[model samples]
Target: MSHFSIIIPSIRARLFDCRSSLFATFVLLSGLFAAGCSGSHDDEVGGTPPATVLQFRLQTLRPEIREIRESITGTGTIGAAQTSNIGVVTPGIVERVFVRVGDRVKKGQPLFQTRKNDYEISEQLARAELTAAEARAEQARLDYERAIDLLGKEFISQAQLDTAANSLKAAKAEAGVAEARLAQAAQRLADTTVRAPYDGVVTGRNADEGTYKSAQTFGADSSVLQLQEIKIVVAVVRVPEIYITRLSIGTPGDIFIGGMDGLFQAEIYAINDKVDMRSRTVEVRFGLANDDYRIKPGLFVQADIHPPERTAMLLEQDAILDRSGDPYVFLLEDGIAQARPVVLREYDPRKVEILSGLGEHESILVGPDLIRLTDGDLIPSIHDADR
Candidate 1:
C-alpha cells in the first residue's frame, strides 16, 4: 500500500504519540524551517529522508565594535624612580647610628652621626684666640691714645705714633677672622652627620659605628643608605616602535600588578624618543600614586596603554575567510553569503578590525566554515538561530 498526503510523509508518519508525538512538533517546526529552507512542493517530491538532506546556510554575524585594551608586557627590575642616596658630604668617624635598615625616614632626618671632638676643640681654641686678640686690641688702643697725647706736646717721634695706631687695627682684624673660623668649624661638625634628602625606606648601609668616612666618593657603590621612594611609583612598559606616534609624554594608562588586582590609574611620565635597534621597541614609563607604599621599586609590573584615537570595525576571528591570499567574509544580503573582501587592519586571534570593505547595519558571517564558502551561496536562514 502507498499513502501520500500534504499533512503527513513517511518521516512524519513513523513518529507517533508514543514517541512524544514528535511528528506534530516536527510538522510545526517544519513550517518555520521549510519556509526559509525552500518554498516549492517539488522539494518534497523526491523520497529524500530528512537526515539525508544537507542544509548549508551562510549566516552573517554582525558583531559590535568591541573596545579593545591593548598592552605590551615587559619584565623590568624595580628602582627608585627618583632615588636619593643619603650620604655625607664631609668626612668623619661615625659616632652614632640614628636609623636602621628598612626604616621609613623623612627629608632632612638625621641618619647617622660622626665624631665632633675635632670641631669642638677648634671652636674652643678659636674662642681663646678671639679673647686674647680683643685684650691686645684694647691695650694697643690705650697706648695709641697716650702716644697721640704725647705727640700733641711733641714728646715722641711721629713714626712711633703711626706704628701704635696700625697695631690696634691689626688686632681688631685678627679677632674678626678668628670668629669667622669658629662658625665655619661648627658647620663642619654638623655636616659630619648624614641626613635623608627625601621620604623613603633605608635599604643599604656602607659604614658602621666608629668607621672612617671621606669627602670624596669611595666608588660607584659609595652610598651609605640606599633609600627608595615608593610613594609615586614608576611602571615601565615596552611597546612596539611602530606605535611611537600613538604614544608620547603625558599619555594616560592603567597598571595591573600581581597581588594588586584592581586597575590602577597611571599617566605616561616618559616616552623614550629613541627606539631600540635590537628589539625595535620603545620604553614607556608610567607614574602611579601608590599611597600605601605598596608599589615598591623593582617589583615586576604590566601596563595596558590605549591609543589616543583609533577607529575600526571589530568582528570575531572566525568570520575571516582566507581564500588564495584574498581574505574575505560572506555577508548576508537578503539572506545569502555574499562573499565580500575586507581590508584587515588588525587580525588578533580573538577578533579582527576592519579598516574598510564593510558597511554599517550589514550582517556578516562569523562561522568557522567561512573559508569553505563562496559568493552567492544560498542561506536557508531567516536570522539563523545558531548565529
Candidate 2:
C-alpha cells in the first residue's frame, strides 16, 4: 500500500526485458527509493516549531533637559587679602608689648610702646619755650600800644613807635616758631606707641620690652609685628593659559580646603595679565568670606572655577553602559532593544550630560540589572500596561 510496493514491480520488468535501458531504469529506481524514504521519515517526525526570542522585563526613563556646567580645576593656597608687617614710626627702645602672636586686634589698637623719656622731655621743653615766647610777645604788644598812644599826643617820637612795632613782630615770629616745635615734639611722643593699621591677627612679634627699634633705621626687611586681616580671605590659584578666556572678574567658584569637609563659595576678583613663561599659567585671585575666621592663611585649597552654563540633555547615570570602551545606551524600539552610541559632555555620580547622539524624548533602559542585554533583544517594559 505504499509507493515502494507499486514501484518494485516496474523496476524488475525493466531490469530483465530491456537490457540496453537497464542502467537508465536502475538510476531512476534508486533516486525514487531515496526520495520515498526521505518523505516517510519527515511524515513520522511531523511539523517544526518556531525559534525562541529572549525577553526581559526592564525599567526605563526619558532623557531630561538641564543646564550643563563645565569647570576648570586647580590647586593653590589660602591667604589673607590684606596683609602688612607693622613697624615703629619713631626711633626708641620697645617699652611694652600689648599683643603677642595669635592675638586679634582692632585698627588703631596699640601693639607696642617705645621709651617716652626723651620724647616727653623734648615736648616739655618746647612747651616752656612757647610760654616764654608768648610772654615776650605780650610785653612787646604792650610796649607798641604805649608808644602809639604817646605818638598820638606827640609824647613819643616816630622812631620809638617804629622800634616798638618791629619788636612786636619779632616776638610774634618767635612764638610761631615755638608753636611748630611743640607740635613736632608732641607728634614724636605719640609715635612711640605703635598701633595696628587695620583689624587683623598678629602673626609675628619681633620686639619685646627691651628690643631697640627705630623708624629711621628700619629697612625694607625690618618688621616688628606681622599682621594679617583674615575676616575675608583670598585664594590665589594659577590657571593654565587655556582656561584664561573662560574666566572673568566676578566669576564664581568653589574652594575646597585641604583637610576640610565642606566647600566654600568664592568669586574671582582679580586676574594677572602677565603669564609666567616657565609654567605658562596666569594667576587668579578669588575672595572668600570667612567672617568666623575658620579659614586660615597658608592652608592648601582646591578650586573649581565654573564657567557659564549651557543647556543639554541629561540622563540618569544608570542608563549608560561602557561597551568595548565606548559609551552606549539601549533604547527600547518596536519591542526590541537597540544599542546607541552617545557623546558625553559631563557627568556626576547621579547623572550625565549627553552632548550628542540622543534625543530629548527617547526612553532608555536604566539600572545595572539590564547590563546583560544584547542588541535586538526583546524588552517588554513593566509599564507597557500604561502605554
Candidate 3:
C-alpha cells in the first residue's frame, strides 16, 4: 500500500544476488522511499490556499482645510508702568510723615513735610528787605520825576537832574534784586513739602519723623520713598532675536500671573530693537490694564502672544497615531488602510494640522479601531454608505 512497504521487500529479494548486496540494496531503497514521502506531504499542506484576508471596520473623515491660530509663550516679570523715587528737593529735617508703604496717593498730594521754621524765617526777612527796597525805589521815582519837571522849568541844574536819574536807576536795580530774593525764598519754603509726581502707590519709605535728608542721599540706589503706578502694569519678556521680526507693537496678548484664577488682557506696547549681546534676546513689553489693582509689581508672569491666523490642512485629533515616537496616521486609500508619516505643523485639543505626507480628498481612520489596522489591510469603512 505504501512505497516504503513495497521497496523493503524488493530489496530483501535482491540482497544475496548483488555485489556487496546488503549495503547496496539498503541504500537504494532508503533514497527512493524518502523522495516519494516528501512529494506526497508537500502536495498535502503546501497546496492549501492562504487564510481569509483581515478586514477592519472603521469610521473615516476627509482632511479639512481651515484657519488655525497659534501662540508663542515667554516668561517675564510683572512691573509697574511707571515708577518714581520721592525725595526731598531741598535739604531739611523731616517734620511729619503723612504716608507710609502701601499708601495710595494722587498727583500733587503731600507725601511728607519737612521742618519749615528756618525757611519761614528766611522768607519773612526777604519780604521785609523787599518792602524797604520798594520804599526807596518809590521815593527815587518821585524825586526823578520832580527833577525832570524842575529841569524842564530851568529851576534845577543839569547835574542835580543827572544825580536824580542815577539814584532812580540804582533803586530800581536794588528793588528787582530784592524781589528775586523773596521769590527764591518762597519757592524754597514751598519745597519743604514733598508731593507725589503722579497717581501711584507708595512702595517704600526710607525716612521717618525727625530724619534728616540731604541732596547726596537721593539717587537710584537711595531714596526717601518709592512710588509706582499700579493701575496699569507691564510684563517685560525677553524674546529671542529670531522671533523679533514676527512681533509688532499693538499685537494683542494675554498675561497669566502666578496663582491667579484668570489671565489679564494685554497688548504689545514696546519692542526693543537692540539685541542683548550675551543672550541674543530682545526685550518686549506687554501692557495690561489692572483697574481692580489685582496685579502688582515684581510678580512672575507668562505672556502668550497671538501672532496671526494661518491656513492649514487639519484632521480630527483621533486620527493621529504614534509609531516608534514619530507621528503618523492610517489613511484610507482605495478602500485599503495605508500608513503614512505626516509632518504635524500644529495642534490643539480637538484637531491637528498636517503640513505634508497627505493631500486633498484623502480620508483618515478614526475611533478606537485605529490601533487594530495595519498597512495594506482592507478597511471596510462603516461611514461609506452614508456618503
- Measured by lDDT, the strongest candidate is 2
lDDT of 3 by residue, 1-387 (tens): 988998998897676567577778889999999989998899797887655666655788888888767777888798998998878877888888889899999999999888899999999999999999999999999999999999999999999999999999999999999999999999999999999998999998877788888866756545678999999988998776756867899878888898788887778889987889998888899887788777889999888889888677988777888823688998877877899998874467787778788886777787667889878887664684126
Across residues 197-241, which tens digit of lDDT does each residue of candidate 1 receive? 788888777777877777687552665667778777778777777
lDDT, each prediction: 0.73, 0.85, 0.84
Pick the TM-score winner. 3
Please give, for residues 210-294, the per-residue lDDT of candidate 2 as tens digits.
8887676654356688899999999999888867878899988898998779988878999998998999888999988888888
Please give the lDDT score for candidate 3.
0.84
lDDT at position 331, candidate 1: 82
- Ranking, TM-score, top scorer first: 3, 2, 1
The TM-score values for the models, in the order shown, are 0.58, 0.62, 0.63
What is candidate 2's local distance difference test score?
0.85
- 1 versus 3: better TM-score goes to: 3
